[model samples]
Target chain A: MKNIRMKVARTEMDLSQEELAKQVGVSRQTIGLIELGKYNPSLNLCIAICKTLSKTLDDLFWED
Target chain B: MKSFFQRNKVKDERITNLQNKIYREIFLIVAAICVLSLIIKQLNHGYSEANIWTEAVILLVSSFYYMIRSTGLGIFSAEVELHNQASKRSMAFKNIVFGLLFGIGIGTFFGIRSAVLYADSTLQSIYYFLLVSLVSFIIYIPFLIVVVGITYLAAKKRSDRAVEKELEDDQDQDEHK
Candidate 1:
């Protein structure tokens, strides 16, 4: 499964990868890897990231 | 399986490397001491001191026993750096204990020989006491230093781990809040 692209959500919130990862309890490298499709964040991490970005999981993580 | 520990491969490798280094150092020291003892015997008494070779042989055999016992744990056991901090500490403690034993054994051997040859128990007793103290201190003091150093570093590592765990816990609580 793929998460919906986070670039748009992050841009909407004006948050950097560092800011998002800190808010999501993950390293910045985790954020970078997620964005680059190198790693898939867990469902919990996805939810956390979405919450921090003020986006619903459906908005940020649902690919279809 | 991706356990919490599995995430830190670098840390694991570093720990293994440390254990292997310690093992190698211990092996070298034991080997060197045995060789030195043989050299001393050869120099002082010629090849007639074949029994010193026997002592060297025993040292080699015991070293083998230790290696075999340790190796069953893993490859890193073949060297010093691979041992866990606790294992290293225990080894240090064991070394100090054994060093004292060796000192006493040597002193007693010499003391008994002197008493038998000279029939002077008082002189032999004094000689044994002095030799035992000297040998024991010589063997144990350096190892005591190493034990102290290793203990300090191990404590530091443990504290660092505790701090990291606390940070992780705080982050978890904050995320929940």
Candidate 2:
């Protein structure tokens, strides 16, 4: 789980890491790590993030 | 946030001080029990009959001291601390209750087996009591260690979860504007 995809998503949505963290129910540090590909969110947290972004888990979280 | 951190630090320090005091008191009581037992043994010239009354007195005193000492530590005042302590108390209580139940069940089964399979005698009855008491205390040691370990881990995990949840909730509420 690298941050490349999270960074891409954030850039596409024009949302800051802090803004995304609020929408998805996580700490800003958590969002930073997600963008930096450091911390892996739990399944529930991943779903919450996907829902907040109007995306699918596979679309936002799945790795190539 | 700064005051919250400071308050938690103060709570940690106060709890630590109280815990140390409790430990010191327990240690002193144990030492006193050992000393009293030694004095009794020496005064009896090392060749006296078993003094059941004296032993019972010692047991009662020690048990009462332990109970009072534990109670005096007082309840955790902070909500977070209370939650952590409650989980610990419940886990420890469960471990003690379950361990004692299991030990008694096993001891009774063995005692019954020995009595039925062999000669049923007064000596055997005494032997059964001794064996069961020794085995039960030994069995309790591992359970005590495990219960303490699990309680510590659970409290730490819960506290971490609470802080994380608080941070998350604060952010969520901020965003609702």
Candidate 3:
């Protein structure tokens, strides 16, 4: 349940969920959960994902 | 940046390692069951038959099980980062629930044991069972309160420390830039 910001950023970066999960060392399911809004990643994880995708935390994770 | 990510990734690995420690998990479950069995056996077989070694094993196993289980569960319960406010609150709630549930279980076991050992008839045993259970619940309430309070406070403090560290890291990164 990825937020729109995250999904859009990852897609724009040409990174699949699996690739992002691999970069961050989390399972695919965890990424999926985060995407689906079923789970929230920790600060470290959020930072990792943002780094891998070349996005800021606000760009990928900020909620309206 | 590499070092920062590596450090945090180490934290993640530590958690994943514990989650994957199946042998320890099995040992913990088995030891807990053994402790319960020992208590039950003592009630049924009488305290005179309770060997000191049995008590020793129960204590040792219980301490290990509790230490590992609580830490592991706390770390692995949610994937949220350790410093997050929600993570802290969630851990606090989890600790409280675990403590209360453990108290209830111990109380029920001891209550039933008391009833079984003292009562001569089945009906009397059943009545004693209920009475003792209620008494056990009452006895455990104060202890549960203390335990839950301490756990929540400790978790909150740790969360604060983690957040402080995160902020410090951010500052360091800004300085580097």
Candidate 4:
């Protein structure tokens, strides 16, 4: 499933996918893929994304 | 100094993963092509040392490079750890089976080459093939098993130490926090 939570968190932080990806030290395409659920980010990458968006892992990645 | 390729490279996990996958696929394809070409040459011209040396060198050099790099990086140990967790069969047993298959392949290749070169008749060819194959198998099997086993054990030891160190470092950080 698409990571709607992460997308929302990024947007709430006033970040585009490119901006979030740059902050996380990944490519814009990778950020897009992650949001689309086409690629699973490694834990380190997930942590970095969470930090960039000011979100906890549970807030951005955990499924209810 | 960074090379042109390195200078322009993107520092992305997905890109790294894609590059690794591409490298593996290309290596396999190249190796397969080389093997097929060698077989075709052998069929048409019979076994000649000249026909095989280039392909053998290419395959051996690439394999050795990959093995050395992976071993140095503890990838082999990580793979063994993953394998142990995911599979019922032990890595050592898998290694032994691999060694056996490799030994048989090499033995057969040498046997066929020698038979083609030195045997005078059909009966003599068959005799030489079996004799050489058995000898080669006997020589390679034990050597491969021992060498591979030692390498696996040493890599595992290194990986275990690295993991322990990481755990200790994490604990130290937790205490500081």
Q: What is the DockQ of each candidate?
A: 0.03, 0.04, 0.06, 0.05
lDDT of 3 by residue, B55-163 (tens): 6677677775664554443432223333233344665567667777877887798779978789999999888888888788788856886777686676545544543
Across B1-177, the per-residue lDDT of candidate 2 in tens digits comes to: 476456543356557779999998986786687668767775776534454456556666876665444333221112333343436565445545665676666666665555555636878866866676567557755675566556545554654554454334222332233
Task: Quote the lDDT for B134 in model 4.
Answer: 93
lDDT of 3 by residue, A1-64 (tens): 4376776787787777656766787754456557666576888999999999898998888877
Q: Could you give candidate 4's per-residue lDDT for residues B11-111 as a string of tens digits?
A: 78777889999999999999998899899998999879998998999898998787666665545555665566567999988987887788889999889
DockQ, candidate no. 1:
0.03
Worst 10-residue lDDT window for candidate 2 chain A reads: A27-36
How many pairs in model 1 have backbone atoms within 3 A of each other, for residues 3 or more apart or on separate chains, i.e. clashes? 17
lDDT of 4 by residue, A1-64 (tens): 7788887787677787656655676655457667767678889999999888888999988988
The prediction achieving the highest lDDT against the true structure is 4
Window of ten residues with lowest summed lDDT in model 1 chain B: B73-82
Candidate models: Cα lDDT each: 0.59, 0.59, 0.66, 0.75
The lowest-lDDT stretch of 10 consecutive residues in candidate 1 chain A is: A1-10
Of models 2 and 4, which has the larger lDDT?
4
| Candidate 3 regions with alpha-carbon error over 4 angstroms | A1-64, B1-89, B172-177
Q: Provide the TM-score, chain A, model 2.
A: 0.82
Ten contiguous residues with the weakest lDDT in model 3 chain B: B168-177
TM-score of each: 0.28, 0.28, 0.45, 0.55
- Each candidate: fraction of true contacts kept? 0.00, 0.00, 0.00, 0.00
User: Backbone clashes in each candidate structure, one number apiece?
Assistant: 17, 0, 5, 0
Q: lDDT for model 3, on a 0 to 1 scale?
A: 0.66
Per-residue lDDT of B90-172 in model 1, one digit per residue for the tens?
A: 55456556655665665566555555555557767677666655665576656655665565445445443443432342222
Measured by TM-score, the strongest candidate is: 4
